[model samples]
Target: MSNIIANQLDLFGAEEQSELFDEDAPTVYYHGDPDRVHARLHRLIAEARGAETLPWDQDSTRLYRKIVPQMVLWLPEEEAAQLRFEFEAELERMKAA
Candidate 1:
């Protein structure tokens, strides 16, 4: 496994085996709610698709602040994998387009 995957497993624990997207923030604060987490993921993916450059600082921070907390709280494992798959697939699609 890649260092990133290994690190994630170590951080989140082995029982929670899941893949996180490369774009995920290294440190996340937990809040609550799974449906909201999914929504934020969808929004982030959409923004990333439309964006020409990486959104960092306030814009990125604001986006992630909403999503990451919920992700950390509710959907640590599956959400990570789902987001990773979606982000990578969307990246590929954009590249092709």
Candidate 2:
């Protein structure tokens, strides 16, 4: 597998991202042991909040753009949205520099 796909799979602990989330649910739910899923989601959100740089490659940037917003869903609704907005804003700022 390509490094991008490999990295995503490793991070999410899922064979496919789609397999990790249910589409029909009002609130997305991950398919896994609850403790593992909770810990992983919290960690992803923390990483996104703390990151000052985009990943060093285009593929990783693409993954970050896609995943971080979803990761924020673990937060309260307003805070989650704000973090997603802030994360994206930072990415744009970095790209423009």
Candidate 3:
């Protein structure tokens, strides 16, 4: 794995990204816990809110790419729909700035 993937796995765990994968897509094993997924999601939400007050350059694509996948993975089936709606809304907010 590349450094980015390794770093992401270290930070968010393998399972968080695995949850976002389609079972039918391919057979790749990821070792991440759901609890870790949940915690990371909450942290990202807090960070995004804080980023609002920071300078524009401080707001970069790297931050979005890192956090978005965790948010998607943290959302469960029942809550997934609502979470996606909120995610898109936040993404739009990011794009506007």
Measured by TM-score, the strongest candidate is 2
Candidate 1 lDDT by residue in tens digits, 45-90: 8886786554446675566556554464467786677786776666
What candidate 1 gets wrong by more than 4 Å, as runs, is 1-31, 58-73, 85-97
Rank order by TM-score, top first? 2, 3, 1
Error of 1 at 87 (Å): 4.2
TM-score of 3: 0.43
Candidate whose lDDT is highest: 1
Cα error, residue 38 of model 2, in Å, equals: 11
Q: Which ten residues in a row have the lowest lDDT in candidate 3?
A: 52-61
Q: Where does candidate 3 stray beyond 4 Å?
A: 1-28, 53-63
54, model 3: CA deviation in Å? 7.6
TM-score head-to-head 2 vs 3, winner: 2
Best-to-worst ranking by lDDT? 1, 2, 3
Candidate 2 per-residue C-alpha lDDT over 1-97 given as tens digits, one digit per residue, 9 for 90 to 100: 6988779767865555664466675775564453553566555555555666654478877887787666666666776676677667767766665
For each candidate in the order shown, give its overall lDDT on alpha carbons: 0.65, 0.64, 0.59
